[model samples]
Target: MKSLTSLQHLSDQAILSILEQADGTEFPDFANRMAANVFLEPSTRTRCSFEMAEMNLGMRSLSIDEAGSSLQKGETLYDTVKTLEAIGVSAVIIRSKEKAFYNELQDVHIPIINAGDGSGDHPTQSLLDLLTIKQEFGSFRSLQIVISGDIRHSRIASANASVLKRLGAEVWFSGPQEWMPDGITPISADEGCRQADVWMSLRTQLERHDAMEPVFPNYLEQFGLTPERAERFKPHTILMHPGPVNRGVELHTSLVEAPFSRIFKQMANGVKVRQAVLAEVLKTKEEKRYEKAV
Candidate 1:
């Protein structure tokens, strides 16, 4: 309850409760308390969604500038978190390139939400994805979701795989062999498209790789959700991406606007998912305070 670094920290009941709350119109008050968003990495969706979530939940938000803050002057993350605590924030949502970047802040009492950490996880994104899938299929049990494209360095793949499996979804991977991770089934993009109930594509993480030339010059033909491969999908098969989509690289540009594509819906649901998360964590903090008072 104090921190949300992984989905494993939550039970099925807990996850369901949050999702239900996300669907409601009622907003919880946090008196005048605030939350800090400290993003050391570039973000658009995650950052904006969380800020909107804060606004909808009746909580003020503080945006930390890593450049302007003492981090540029070599301040440790622990000290920065402690400073936010000193400023009386109720929670801290952080995104950094270092995996488990907040692990060292054992003494910091505020709730810490991990926005993302290297190729580690994007739990909130996965939760919204679950919400989107649940809306479409009613449940995750026995559903087939084929995730295609860059699997080796995608945090979305790592986060979604664990949660989807926990909810009884069969996850398959389709991409170049070099992009395949250990234990993932190496299905071809076309075959995966034909068999999937959902087709999720990923952006190539060029930033994560060291100096290298393009391994596959024709990535669209080799691994992308090209129009031909997309045509092979069943009528009910949905398309999804945790985007900043490389239009033709991961999926065809036209497919992004396809009727089955839930990419924009995913962005919309992100605010609700984050609102529920912030409310739940802040509510726990409130209860703890009341308990000590009694």
Candidate 2:
């Protein structure tokens, strides 16, 4: 069984296979199999989308959160996963506050899908984003994509930027200087707007920040996709955000549902992308079992 822990480990062929599966109409049957969602951190999109994907694939699923789980009693994450596996879970999806949380579960038998891990990576989100971009532009090569906003605090930024660059897209970072990560020189918001073929915004992670003060007092005017800035974008430029969006901060409220916005499309694609991932992992396990039986 293969666990999808990071996009870095997902090969080009595997990515193509997942995207192709997502585009197909037939659903694979895993009717008797069970999956578990262990979210140590709060989530809305990733969690619900995985649950929907599991349901659509005919898999029984259990949802566990920190408040209701044994972790509150000081049980470690590794133990929780092993317990789930012992209980006959076919796979486990985890979203934890710890970076690279999957490192501890190397011995677990079942597949572990990383929903999100601290500010480290969000592979599924990157997949859905790729699906969205591919559907729009037909390819990733030479695409000028700008990922703007809370860079340091965003798992999406690191995940998407790395994959996009590897796929031959010219990825640029844009946001407040303090939020930018090392080795990435961010362009001004206007420069990003003028050049980007795909402009992606990231929500300011207030929950991750220690200071309550705004990172930039005039964030919307200086770095956001305001109506005026939107006009500067090329006619074909499309907008994207890994939600939940800070309406007036990361992007102007008017731009959320604007004609070029692919924000909702990204959410819809999340289910399909996850369905493809789940199917691949489970089917691989089945294939190996069949081989052993033979």
Candidate 3:
């Protein structure tokens, strides 16, 4: 309770505890009582991940969107954050299109779990991803993870790369010149996959709307991931995506469902990582409560 901040130095044991919780096996409280967001950005995997996190831990869940909740009246982001905190949201899981979504939170001090902040960072996403990585290799060192495609517009690439690098993997990237992350090695698509222990395909987000470039398909043919391309990698290399994949665009759908795919496992780990985050935040609050009374 003396601390109110989330730490990047989260312990391995604590991380393990959450993973265990996700099994719905046995835990002290299930404290199963938490509040979080849904459908703000038309999500499937993230939306469900937070919801399942709540159910598995014993938290009643709620959904919010333009049509779902009343924020349609030009309410600002800070107001939204403050209101949620005021109503005792112990932890918040957000997914916003704006890259700086949590930047101007005029002191809305709840534990802001970044489900995503556009192409900026998705901290929880990073956590689950690393969890998946750890689950696959039983450790973080020396795993060659390739993050491919949509470099500029995909949060997963940045988050996954950050986490992978943090945990000691040699992470490489491959995508269009425009989408690449700054200050990282960019390998040719084939070479990247060839050397990787995990291949993560990020969806090309351009064609979602009507106004887009004509060179998209050409780009896909060159950069998109396919089974043949994926086969160039180590046979045990895992495949991943943050979903809403473009079938045959950034990646070939069949390859994504290949035997080595860990996309579903990564998605499933989101619930566990969130439960861990929520547990730490709420436990901090409870500790503070007792300290204040004393």
Candidate 4:
């Protein structure tokens, strides 16, 4: 078993195992968690998911914000991390716009759970995505998922690509050249959708500041998944998004509330997935101690 430096820490078999273990516990006693919340970027879903996961595990937590920390006094990120670790932090659930923080963090004794990092990878999103897929399709094999919009700046897309591919599924990239990843394909947007077993639409994150002239007008005309296309793949496909959704932009508002949509359920899985991750980490730590005693 590998330590969870990234989402790839848990294999497909491990992921299912963790989920199974989590199922044996009730909602409020999922994994017996206790940790420090260290968020650099603002988040609602990641924050609440992690907190709820901790609560479900019957653990206490501390939430740190820039305004209350010496980080505002110009403390280096390394210093901040060291301070958190020194205070006996069991783990740090971090959200940063810089990837360097995540890379440097992998060497630490304390576990680091990335909420989001420099638009690179969001593993938890990948986990919930898998949970959603399993819940709806009842399996992961041979699923054709279309990833549309902001591919160049979408960490969720990258994580999804890796996790889905590892689980024996196909993924297509769709978006304009400016917003899309360079030299990668399923290049055509319309075609990607037409053949998709599932369509996952993403918001164009202007915060990445990766693209210019942010024109998002008439989004439904080109990028948004509509009622018509929904019916086209209705027999075989599903739609998913990670949002603060742009109502008429990347997806129709109605689709967000549709029976097939896993938006809310995904958020709920955030807690369970995280709870399972913490449990696994704790179990590993305990076994090491037992080995030393024996």
Candidate 2: lDDT over CA atoms? 0.91
- Per-residue lDDT over 1-294 for candidate 4, one digit per residue giving the tens place of the 0 to 100 score: 324545676768887776566545544343444588878888898888889888767777889877788889999767787888787666777888887466765557666777788788887777777887887877778988889888888889888888888888988888766776667754565677678887888887888854445676776877667776676665657778877677887878888988777788778877878887776676676677689899
In candidate 3, what are the lDDT values of residues 1-294, reduced to their tens digit?
211122244555554555555434443454545575734576887778788877766777556675655567888767776787788666667777777676676386666666766666776677777777777777878888888887766777766666567657887789766566466556788888778888888877663323553346576578888777876878688888878777878887787677888877887788777766666666776777789899
Tens-digit lDDT string for candidate 1 (16-78): 777778877587676587999999999999999999989877789899868878999999999
- In model 1, state the lDDT of residue 47: 98
As a whole number from 0 to 100, the lDDT of residue 97 in candidate 1 is 90
The lDDT-based order of candidates, best leading, equals: 2, 1, 4, 3
Residue-level error in angstroms, candidate 1, position 35: 1.1
Lowest-scoring 10 consecutive residues by lDDT in candidate 4? 25-34
- Best candidate, lDDT: 2
- Model 4: residue 152 alpha-carbon error in angstroms: 0.7
Candidate 4 stretches greater than 4 Å from native: 1-3, 22-33, 186-189, 210-214
lDDT score at residue 239, model 4, on the 0-100 scale: 77
lDDT (Cα atoms) of all candidates against the true structure: 0.88, 0.91, 0.69, 0.75
- The window of 10 residues in a row where model 3 has the poorest summed lDDT is 1-10
Worst lDDT 10-window in candidate 1:
208-217
Q: What TM-score number comes out for model 2? A: 0.97
